[model samples]
Target: MREKLGKISNFLVSLAAGIASFVFTLVAVLVVTDFNEKLAASLIMGLFALLIVWVASEQPNSSQARAVSALIKRLLAVGSGDLTSPTPAAVRREMPALAAAVDNLFEQVRSNLDNVHAIALYDPVTSLPNRVHFKREADRVLKARGWDDGVALLFIDLDGFKEVNDSLGHAQGDQVLTMVANRLRIVVKAETREDSLAPPLLARLAGDEFTLLFPRVREPAEAERIAQSALVALCEPFEVGEQTIDMGASIGVALSPRHGTDLAALMKAADIAMYHAKESGRSQASMFHARMAAAFEEKVQTEKALREALGRSEFELAYQPQLDARSGVVVAGEALIRWNHPYDGLRLPDSFIGIAEESSLIVDIGDWVIDGVAATAARWHARGMAQRLTFNVSPKQIERADFFDRLRAAVERHQAPLRMLELEITETLVMKCGDRVIAELAALRAEGLSIAIDDFGSGYSNLARLKDMPLDRVKLDRSLTADVDRSEGALAIVTAVIHLIHGVGCEVVGEGVERREQLDLLRAVGCDVVQGFAFSEALAETEFLDWVRDNAPLRLLPRSA
Candidate 1:
């Protein structure tokens, strides 16, 4: 009886201790943990209860009792976060199902933790290390190296990615981004040194932007070589699904100690250099320089001013006369935009147009131009001037879904005749816009507006497709006409181009004519219209009207005489 009582007392004591532990762990887990953790806690409590029952039913020194005791000790260790503790083989043999369940629970918890860690550190779309991880890893490597050797950082930004997303769906865009990340990884991996203390690191900073870090770079030439490799890798066409997409990357290279010493500084330098690469042209790399920073500052200020210019009514138009080559008579004028900036004096399109185009501010500016030109054309028509006026169009303006409606509204609002106005589109824009643009242009033509291909011969265009366009005329770029008077080669090209335009039922306008020899050669080649400084430079609204009246004598003279 004494022995039985002692065994019973010892079992009660063990059961009480196990119950207290279960209660404490259960309270904590229920209060602060997730469903999985609560479930784990409940299973542990059940295990302890089973052990208590086993101890009460078994002999004082049985194998069951020993296994229960060992499992209780292991469970205690596990509850305190020591996952390395394992259920004894005796416990597994005695309670195979329960021991397997516990082991599976622990394995699942570990796998869940790994998944959470990856979600926090990597980009979900491309599976590349994100900005947070990139910064952390870059800082660690930079500190470990002690700044003994130079490091090169490249900031990569994709060009024309937005257009891809706009044309194709976001799903396709994600595929492009994934392919881009994989290619970048391959390029960096190929350049990685096998024995270097710090290998190259690559990360996706954000949408359409990535970074590459090269450690232990000894020369700028080495950095340049890697940058070129990256450019070439990205320049190749990416095949996504059934469609082939052409892409390009602009890279900015920044060297340690020269451009910056820390991650933030290096990022800023590399970013600025990348902007320079984009400005020079995409699909290239640019090195960090102090002047680039200054230029970037200027560009920012100019963009801000341009955005505000429309609101301030600081914009005006100047017209350069286009005369009939056969009659030597002023027949039309091309409208050019000018900004009368308050702080910078007068600024031409070359000084700020590219900046406007980049920010998409040109859309608003183009609207303003269209309204202003329509109003002016109305006034001209009211005064009996039937001569047509041409205005350049931007790709952004054409891309808007409501472009046609907005244009027609502007003309209707000004009560202007469509025949008195013409639209000029560049050759490159025409090619890029494809069939939709052709259909739109035909619709616009049906509405009585004339369409002209501007800057001809300056860009690539399929001659076979030229006949399909709704064009009234084709303007010869100054590049082709500048040397026509001096070079037979240039003159021959011009003559052939004129005949081609004629074949397509379109007249040819030779621009930038600054000399009699050039004019005579153009006239001899069957050019229809001429415009440049030789006749008149771009003039203000009032100056143009005055010059027109002043040059009435030259209007009737035949150039063929």
Candidate 2:
């Protein structure tokens, strides 16, 4: 009540000052119009008296102006961030409604900023804190730990997610991703203790990729346990609409101080580890180790060397003789690519083929392989060794837009006999290279070339898919042929494979038959051909020809199909 009375008193004082000024102006005007000395003197005296009265009245209201100044100061303070302090009641009394409105506006602005920060820091889909929040938390916590407390980052990528997206449609794929996100959150929560300092934070980094961070990790086992729990939980089939889907995760774990003290370094190490997991087999996890770093460097070197090797003509094929089981004669040869690196002696296909296939180098390397083998076959044909020459074909090579054209060109350039140039494709190529590959292979077969299923029993055994393929032969994979001599189970598998191959109108070739006993077992199973070290290891063209010349009746003399 006093505050309102003070405002009313100030208003009345201001009104009195205005009235005093108006009376002084009127008296002066009257004195000027009269133009008399006595009248002017009287008017000046009255004006002076009125001015004195106005000054006296205004002096008592000085505190009101001071109060207004203080109110302005308080508003400036609010603008400059003295947020907790409220405007004084005396100053607010000068303008109560305006003061209250300003305070409310400030609060609304602060709230909007907080909400904006949350929107910027969290993922809309999962409602989980996002990469920005993760990095911020990781950086601050890791620095605070100071290499004393442990920190771990788990980088996870979904396996076969692309297939799921492509086959089941993206809506279903998103449902799977959301299901995975929920599963990850639940598992991480269960692993963390109620009073844990810096519990595990699970964030979806991007589509089908997530990173789980454990601050004050304490030990590697904890991270691994969390990883195992998350993976096991994630893989459980998710039901969306009418369908149930199975999923798998590849996890890469990296620890602080050991891997690195920062989020970027830890993430990189974890990514590399995750890649290793995928390479070993998806649905598994690998911890960051020094050896994995070395392996990564080696792979980089191999990629560089492979690119150089192709141009330097450092790659060569070693022909492994495949024999006719019935005749015991070397009827054909499989061309295996070997890289004789100038720095590192000989590198087998297993050592570098994966690297090549992953990079753009595969296309060039594959082209060279096809060309070199075709040229070699031409030479063998000229030497009266008309044995068919088969070469392993990478799926990438076969899936190329110009694969058929390139193969045709290579054969024509070398004058290779189409019937004698066989291409060996893996089971993955047969089953998973999409219909494009199948259609292309069918076209290639129509051109009078033979296509064989290489590493047969080792890959997806889909008979329906195989029936559609134009396969000339099924080379029993090395795994099934390794111990067929002693293991009844092994022999039984080989027998069944041979029967299956024959049923599909394709011949069976036993691979890696290192013993005569294995060979006898394969022959008993009606294997049509065999390729192994037992007969002859892979050799250079000169050595291979020499081997053929020395062995009687094994030489590929001019023979008709």
Candidate 3:
């Protein structure tokens, strides 16, 4: 188009020059003939110059207009289709600078558009396909697969993620999520290579929620293996900034055309499976089964029943005496919690404590236990049956912002002597958050309450840690007592543990002492206290009161001399 305009402009200038030359020749001839004729020639030359300017500006050939129309059509085609057209040589030469600039602009626009599209389809944070793109790809893959073949959708939800955010802050939480995403990517990539079929697609659905679509999975086991790998990957500690956080994930997997034939169904099934994974225990993976759905429905009913039970105050405490091994005297009684669900009857910790822990009902439940046990102990103290009352403390409860304040209030409310209260914490709990546990224990001990380590040697049993921690006593794990008859190693370990704990000026209590030999070995090993079926099981509140009254001086060996 510009080339045509240039040609017309040149022709106009040439024509004007020819006309001016002719007029100049005439003026020269007139000048020679008569000097007065020069003015007329000048007037004619000016008229030709004006005509040249007008014609040069006009599109006389209509070629420039036609070329412009063609150029616009080409540009529209490039916009609609692939933009691979080359600029014409004529256009380039006629408008060299403008043509070059336009070409560069088009290329830049194309590059930017590509980037925008890529980001829209994939998350920049994880580099995984976003939900929008994953759904599209999953549908395509499922539709193409034969009925005999199967696809699996694994939904992964991280456990305790909120704790990471709460304790470490959101920046560290994001770092952990990024690390999880990277691990998932590696696992999915590996699976894709193994199958050699339609490779699986992994995506981040939202915060701490990710999805993996395995195409053409050979069998249910393939999906199971993938889920297991994901669980293992997530179980490893995440190194975030200066701290290492133990972040774990639960995965639920559902197979297409089996669990669900459509996206919504598949998603629902996967969600249900994920819930099961969390309910069964965090840091595990579960596959969708018909029974799991049934169990989930039952769990929903159980949760409702539990909440109702709580409102009705149907929960109670059972006391088991912690006997001084040498004298057989009940120096303290450990408070064992029981849920007297109206419908479910008496329930033990094994049945419901897990549910409480997962739902964070442990804090409320733990408080109830503390208050009820403290009140019972206070009553006993008023009746001249005063003995230390021990209650278990969950890690979740200890980590609460108001743990110490709430505990202090509970003791004051019950008017229970702080010296007669003992808090039993598991070794695993202590090791999980050592500094926090130590500080909390020190505070509680300073308040005149005793602290005992429960299930000692069940976790990182560092002797130095035990010596440094603010603990008054340690409870030997039941495993050690159970194996005392079968393994000399077990007996030696118990003996060493007792000596070590005593060396640190802390008392040792033996748990699960069911047989005479076990009790004898524990006493011989210098255990200060013993509690198990060997004496009696946990008793009802009234039965415990009577037993405490009747068994006044509980003697272990009847003062053998």
Candidate 4:
């Protein structure tokens, strides 16, 4: 009784002492404080005495202490990610409020982690798994794949998406993207329902680039069918807020265990195929092959070398002169670029022009050509060897927003007379370019730059449209003039084209006139200018200048004019 009640007796004594101390504190604080301060102090002292008694009674082995220890262990376990472990009832009953707070905190942390993961792994706009997640899923599928399992990846790039974004605002572009995503989802989901195959994994790899993975397909054709379905779905024009937009997709397909066994290889193959499809004209699909990757790698190497070539000044112009059929003299010269490659000897325009055009290196390349041609032609003008210098202009350069501005700047910088510089565009470019492009060309023509439709019969010929275009010359493609002497039908076609071009007040030029009979036919058909291997091939600058000196009275137009 003495030992047990001793704790209570000590607590009573401590309570008495605390009361006296509280009174002293109130007296001291009352001097500088209010009645509320004294009342709070007395109550705090009483609670302190009871806390001491409770602390003394609850030893390390007491139920309260045991409950606290159990709670600590549970908290440590929770911190260690053992959320499934049960919370002890002793801890909860002893400290219900604290237990409740800990449980809520645990859930909150878990929720935050999940939300962070979702944000990191998902595209918010399309609500599709991102590239990282897609690659992870691909790896998982590949690992679990059976011996005969074939997985296919389709890399889909939206054709003309940049155009839409440029013409319409970004808001409109976003709407278009969301709609496209929805269409893809619907098409893939619908196909999955019909076939008992596992659902296709769709992901938005990046802006305007989406990917579809068939992880459990038995054959590559199944992947292609899904691509077809998606393309068909996109074929229908999308409507956004009273405006209808036309969009197309280019797809590249790669099969697993054939094209590649991993995500990187498969994506690479598909990417190459997709790029090829885009180049071959959009709204198409292509399959990945080993050769495709090899070709792509080669192209990349070539592009890099081309950039170095530009920097090293390894390029030069080879001139091929045009002759007057009546006078039998060289009249004007066409400036053709040649790359004097260090190891590959001389590289022709055909070897690299397509690559340049595709990569938009043409813009820089065209600038280089313009500067070089303008400077060279300026020198020729000073030497009385002046003739209208014709140089091919890429279609992309014509469409560039800064083309005219840059052209005018280059001409001024080189002090080359615009009248002496002739820009030749392919018929394919002129026919497809917007009216705005024609308007730009007219502005260039206004500056006295002559425009010729090069390779006139190559395609996209609208005779009526040609009349409206500002033109000074029409170069009939070599195909129309190749067998002019061998076939009367060819001569008739050439004669008709010449007559039609003459009617449009444009001079007619025949290309690829190698045979004397071809020249005779061209003269008979009233063709004004002829260029081919018959008279002279494209020559180096020195060779051309010497040839110009050798052939006197070959000037087509006066330099001052």
RMSD, one per candidate, in order: 11.8, 7.5, 7.9, 7.9
TM-score of 1: 0.79
Identify the leading candidate in terms of lDDT. 1
lDDT of each: 0.88, 0.83, 0.82, 0.83
- State the lDDT of candidate 3 residue by residue for 459-501, as single tens digits: 6777777777888999988987897866899999889888989
lDDT of 2: 0.83
Q: Can you give the lDDT of residue 512 in candidate 4?
A: 89
RMSD of 1: 11.8
Mind giving the per-residue lDDT tens digits that candidate 4 earns over 475-506? 99999999999998989999999999999999
Q: Total clashing residue pairs per candidate?
A: 0, 0, 5, 0
Residue range with the least summed lDDT across 10 consecutive positions in model 2: 552-561
Residue 139 lDDT (model 3): 86
Q: Write down the lDDT that model 4 would get.
A: 0.83
TM-score each candidate: 0.79, 0.73, 0.71, 0.73
Say which prediction, candidate 2 or candidate 3, comes out ahead on TM-score: 2
Least accurate 10 contiguous residues by lDDT in model 1: 552-561
Q: Write the per-residue lDDT of candidate 2 for residues 1-561, one digit (tens) a residue.
A: 655776787777667777766787676666555548657666776786677676656655444566677778876886677766776676567678867876787688778878898889987777777888888887877777744788888999998897788668898888788888898888887877775567778887877889998777768998898889888987788898988877789999999988997788899899989989999989998999989988988888889888889879999999988888766787888899999989789988989989888788988988998999889988877877778899988877887788888988999999988878899998976877677677777887888788998998786789877788888998888999998988888888778878987998999999998887877778877999988888899999898888777764554322222
